[model samples]
Every structure is written in C-alpha cells, then in structure tokens.
Target chain A: MSENLIPLEQLQKTCLYDSHVALGAKMSPFAGFMMPIQYDSITVEHNAVRQKVGMFDVSHMGEIFVKGPEAEAFINHIFTNDIRGYEPGKVLYGMMCYPDGGTVDDLLVYREYLANHFLLVVNAANIDKDFDWIQEHAKGFDCKLDNASPRIGQIALQGPEAEKTIIEVLGYKEAADLGFYTFCDVEYNGERLILSRTGYTGEDGFELYTTNENIVEIWDKFLKAGVQPCGLGCRDTLRFEAGLPLYGDELSPEISPVMAGLGMFCKYEKDFIGKETLLDQKAGNLEKKLVGIEIEDKAIPRAGYPVETPEGEEVGVVTTGYHSISLDKSICFALVKKEYSALDTPLCIRIRKKVFPGKVVKKRFYQTNYKK
Target chain B: MSKILDELKYSESHEWVKVEGNIAYVGVTDFAQKEMGDITYVDMPEEGDDVLAGEEFGALESVKASSELISPVSGTVVLVNAELEDAPEKVNEDAYGAWIIKVEMSMPSELDKLMDAAAYKKMIGE
Candidate 1:
C-alpha cells in the first residue's frame, strides 16, 4: 500500500506513449515520466533479451553535450575515468562524484565524431540534478554545456541476436562491424542517429540515439520485425543479473565507486572530484564495501533489508536483491562492513520476520555474454 | 478483467476468503495478481500460527515490489499451499485456485463484514 502518492497529472509522458498504449503496456510513473513497466510479462521480456533480441524505450535517459577546446579537461575533472587517450568514437563508463567521493551519477561518456565534442548519458532521475551540477562546475572551464535530454530519444537493441536484428530490421549494416565500447553517427532517411555498441545488459547490443520522430519510426520498424518490446522491469533484472550497478540502488551519494568495487573505472593518475577520498580508500582506509550475498532460502532479500551476523549483530543493509530469474537463486548486493565482505564470509539477511543464513559470494550470479 | 467468484467474500485490500463451516480458505484476488504482474514468491505463515482480521500474515513478492498478505478473518492457520514455495507463478495463473492458506476460523461471523463479488467488482472500478 506504500506506493508513490504523486498525482498522475504531474508526470511527463514520452514521445512513444501512444505506441506503448497500442501495445497494451502497463504504464507506471518512474523518474518523473510515465514509462512502460511491461507489455507482456517481465519474465518473457527478460528471456527474450537474454536468448534472442529485445528493444527498450530508454528515451527518459538524459543526454548532455559538452563541446569546446577545454571539453576534455572539463570532463576529466568531473568524471572518474581517464578520457585523455579515448578516440573520437570511444565510450567510457564512469561516475561523477562529490568532493567526499560519493557518486553524483554513473554515466557513459561518448566521444562524438567531432573533435572535443563529448556526450554524457546519465540516469533519468538525475537528469535535472546532473545538469545543474555540471553547469555549476563549468563556470571555471571554457566548455559549452547543453542539456539535450528533452530533444533526443533512445532505444536499446540488446541480446545475442541484436546485431542481426539491427542489420535486418533497421537496415543499419555498419553496426555489425562496430567494436565494443565504440559508436558511429549515421544518417538514415535524412535523420542523424548515434549508434553505440554499448548497453547496460551484458549482451551484444547497440543503443541508438536520434530525434523523437526517428525513434518512433525505428520503434515501429522493430515491432514489425517481431522484436520483443522490453520494459523497465526487465531492464533492472537484466542489469542486476549482469552485475551492473544501478545509480540509486548500488551507487549513491553515500556509496563510493571504490566501495562498490568499481575502482578500475577510476583512474588514480587523474585528479578528479573525490580523488583524495578515493585514493585514501584505495589505500585500505574504507569502512564498508559492497559484496554479493546469496541466500539458500527461497525468500527474497529485498532492498533496505538489514543484514546481520549469525548471532544478531547488524552488519549492513541490502541495496538491491531478487530471486534471480535466470540463475534461480535468491541473490543481492549489500554494502557490508569491510571485514565481512570477503568471499565465503557467512552472513544473514532479514526477510520480513525471518533471518535467512547466506554467504558472501561474487556479485555476478550470471556470467556475462557480452561480445568482446 | 479478472475473475471474481460470486460466492466468495472479498476484502478491500484484495484478499478473498471462502468459508465452509468453521474452516476458511484465503488467497489473493485475481485483480491483485494482475496488478502485481508476476508472482515470484509467497511468504506464508506456519501452520498453527494465529492471525487476526486485517493483520498482515505474510507477503507476496513480484518482480517490482512486495505486497503484504492481510488476513480477512481471525483464525489459526491449519495448512499452507507448499507448492507455492517452488511454483509461485501458479497464483498468477489462477489466483483463486492457488489458495495460499486454510484457516480454522475462530469467528465465522467476520465473513458478514466482508464484501461479496458484486461489491468487489464495483470497488475495483470494473
């Protein structure tokens, strides 16, 4: 009964609202937008992406453009990842952080076709906040920042057969040759679209960004070609199964990328926001760390559930958990005390009134099938 | 539209109860299963555990969120559908057919306070 009490009138609808309604999708308010939670079933859509091909309406994700002579310097100052040596068509996954190392948002930085032109794809909920934060920091830099979230629409074609679907359905044959973490700008039917070989799902996939009208055309084309239309429900499940971190769940203002075990994305050689704190944590001064907890019981360990020791001492709290659809096991990510984060460390998760015994395991319950 | 049995009693919280003599069977309504999307797990109370009217006895988990299973009548749990422990999707398949618990009703009079199928249909804006 504890649902969001926000009025439906206040929510914004995407350009594909009519399409989703025509497909009999279940619409729900998410991140200030009325998004499709499911069209058929979460399991069915999830399996489609895992086994064959599926497309998701990801237009709610924010797209910010940074361009100028100081663009790379400005991005490197805010982003944790090193972007100095990235080619024009490269994409890097990293996070923007506060001075204390807490994450502002985890994003994908796409180096555009034009020199010194970079595109930052951020979470839907953090669009406005991230834009304001970036604008505030750009005062010192000479980069021109543009918040293009409302002007663009995105679709993710994901699965083992994603490349084939893109070629056969959208007629974008060049996508078949794109390398991992690379992108290209193509003009189709007089419309410019950015196709990137990067996805949140651990599958061989591509994300297409274009104008709203072109997105609608592409969506219709995919639907006609029999590609499954996925929703936010399976999107979370797919990313979770692949051990990818969700912004509000696994990464947050209180949780650092280092604490979340994403230290590799943070290059210590560059001095970015939260560099000092992250460097100190890398030297083994952190208190809590994220770890995977797998429960033997069928009862799921949900978010905010207390993680405890066998004798009832509270150790941490679950950030995200589920009875994994693919793995068929109750698994979760918890930010536990650093000492208890080691593999094989026994832990307990309190589900409702019962405390189920579990053990610390690798976060990846399902092995990724990303086409390297 | 979800199926609503005319002979069954329903709660505002979407629980359905079928009373027979002193025993009553409880399960989530079809409307609830549809609203919940897919049923991943059902947390059921142990046999012989006491439950009061309108109190939460267990929960039903879906992919998105968990919904508390509120008791429609006061009773002691006599049996639980153990099959749901492994095949929770059965509820999504047939909500009424997949009864969650059988209770030995301590007060069968509580059934009179619940709505009938007609009232439940109207309450859900059908």
Candidate 2:
C-alpha cells in the first residue's frame, strides 16, 4: 500500500514507547506515533520545563543527508537561506519551497565537517514527499541525497537548567559556550554523534543526534540522571507560547511567505523558484496576517474557528489555540485581516456556538530564552 | 476499582446522576475523569436551561482535547458547580464529589433508563 493511504489504525511506533509507558506518560497518536502527550498535568509538565529541566523524544522528525559535488548549489536553490555563508559545524533555519513559492517544509540545515554535505532535519509527516521533491530538483546537479530519517534518533534536552544537566551527565566542559546554531561531534559511550544547541521549546537547550541503535541506551542514561520526560501536549503549548508556527497551521501550499510574516527568510538576491509571485504579494496589501490573540473570556480558540470583530464582522480564522500555561490565559494564533492585526485590537472568537471577546497581542506570548 | 455508591446512577458516557427528590446532581464517573487528563475547562449549562436526556449538556476540556458531558437524566439546570469555574481540575481529582451541574427533572422517569454502579462498571469493561 502507498504510505499516505495507510489507515490511521495502522500507525507507526517510536523507539521510546516502552520508556514513555514506564514514566507514566499519557500516550496518544500524534503525527502517526503513540507518543507521550504528558506525564503529569500538562500545566505542571509545561511549567517544569520552562522553569527547570525537561527532555523530549523528538526522534519522529525526519533527517535527510545531502552530499556530493553539486550539493552546495543544489541545496541553495531549494531552500530560502543562502547556503554559501554556512561553514562547517554551523546550522541554518530555512524553508524548502515549491516552484510556486508554497512551503514544502521548514527545516534545519546542518553543515557537516570538511565537506559540502548537509543534514536536513524536516517534519516527519513530509518525509517521503520531501525526499521525492529533492530528488526531482536534483536534475543537472551531480549530488546524492539520501533519506536517513529511519536510521537516526533525536533527543532534545531543553529548559533553563539544560546546561547544568548536560555538564553533569556527560562531563562535557565548555559545551554551553557553543553558541546557538553551532554543533560539535562528541563521543557518547565510545559512539561519535553530533550535539547541537537547538530545541523546539523557547529555552536554553541541546539536541543529541545519534544513530537509532544507540538511542535507547542514551535515553536510559538521561532518564537515570533525572531528565523529566515531556510529551507533545506541553510541546504544542511551549511552541505556541514562543510564537513558533506548526507546519500544517501557519504554513501550507495555500499560504505565501509574505502573508505568513516569514518574508525575512526569503532572499531577494537569489534566482530561485517562486520569487516573482512572492515579490508581487510583498508589494501589495496582505489579505491575511498572523496575529497572536488573548481571550479574556473562558473560551479556547481552536483551529478552523471563525474570528470576528466585536461588531460581528468576519475577519479571519484561528490557526491554533489552547489554554496557554505560560500566559495564564487562553491564547491563539489567527490569520486575520490587516485591519485587525494591530496589537490590542479587540476582536471576538466564535468557539462552537458561543462568541468570546479577545484582543490581538504582540507575537511571542511568553518571553523566549533563545540565546542571543 | 472504586466504590460505586448505590444511590447514584450512571450513563454509558460515564456520567453519574444522583437523584434528590425532583432535582439531580450530575458529575462524571471516576473512570471517565481518569481517561480525560487534567481537566482545564468545564463548559457547564447555566441555570434555567432545559437539557434533554442522552444529549450533550456541556463539554469538559482537557489539556489534550475536549469530551462532551452527556446528560443521563434530562431536566432544567438549576445550578452549575460554580467552583469548577476557578478549579476545573477538581473534576479530575474527584469526579463524584465535583458534580458539574444540578438539575430539576422535567420527567423523573428518565432516571430509570440509567444503570446502577454495578451495571455501569460492566459497561466500562471494568
């Protein structure tokens, strides 16, 4: 059977299933894995990581290996980032786009040591399609791109106390000084792997990249050293709090970079796909703009819900929302009309049958701890 | 594995109905609360609102998702547990004690359709 048509009932499993169960994680289906949504209360787990230390099993993210002579030019053509400036051990946050300027996937491009090869970490759901897309785009370039997602495991150690936890566990001195977006290859149990100061949560953290064979052992060590196991429930809340957009929500084939407020990542100097259309959209009035909202009422603004002004005029729709622990208020991201995008502009959300009052707020609902 | 009091009746949706004269106290069974993790918000019916039997009166929102609070015995809502407005997690902590709403029954015979504690457990595969 084709991968996309596989029934939801025939879902795949992650490597940490048994460990999550042992830690009392509330397991649920997310992006096709029976992953942990939370161990304790979602608020408690969320606050714990924001204040102290927490670790997440993010192995579900897809990682692809792109190498060979034409790797540099080929990757630069597909991604929005200018890859020429990237040095060995440096990583770049970029989005892969279709010829029409629609986002295929947002990914982290890691430059490997002493080579033009790059490691592209992508969203799990878009693995197969992304691989095919890259292969199709490799027309005249003498480059080899391989799907290495299934063979790798990724663990994120995040939060304010992340540095302390890392030093204590691995005895790696000066690891904290490795600036954001920089990584180093280190030996773990005699196995060489990469450790990058990167995370989804808006906190000081490091992501351990290793082969699938060594993942279980590394996870066990982290657990033994008291890394609180976090799940997807808090993961969603944390990213929302940080004002990070989910792929299916803030990005899709229908939305352009200008409307999504991610035009800064698009390089104007480069001749790549979809430049003309994006430039046109950027030059004109944006029909919809992503804005952060805070609900004064008890209603939670979920996706596909209609957003309206207090006068009951249809403005836009909510992309994602829930009871945000960091804000201590109901928060949501909505793509509203430019007129209603100003900060503190009052609006109303239609959740189910009830209409609740809300206001547009500045992005980053909670202060992020990303290294400056 | 909880002690189900006989006076309370249960619904297939795992809500409990405690009858006191023509009024009934409605809450979720311990089994239901355990399944819905960390209740964040309880959308309860307001006073004077008429509810139908086996219909959704309100919903209990959890950190992950929301589940409907189905009425076992329909009636006019006399009062909602005001305490839940401030501490919705109380439902997850103690389901039976944290009755979501109280209703004045329009048809008292609606209680007859519910299952007692023993039958409710059997329905839950307990």
Which prediction has the highest lDDT against the true structure?
1
lDDT of 2 by residue, A97-196 (tens): 7767678888888998959788899998788888898899988999888898878888888898888888898777667777888888888768767889
TM-score of chain A of each: 0.98, 0.94
Residue B90 in model 2: lDDT: 95
lDDT of 1: 0.93
Error of 1 at A87 (Å): 1.8
Off by over 4 Å in 1: A1-7
Q: Which runs in model 2 stand beyond 4 Å of their true positions?
A: A1-10
Model 2, residue pairs in steric clash: none
RMSD in angstroms between candidate 2 and the native structure over all alpha carbons: 2.2
Lowest summed lDDT window (length 10), candidate 2 chain A: A1-10
Q: Write the per-residue lDDT of candidate 2 for residues B1-126, one digit (tens) a residue.
A: 754667899988889998889999999988888888778898887798889998989889876677888888878998999999999989978888999989999999988888988898778886
C-alpha DockQ for predicted model 2: 0.62
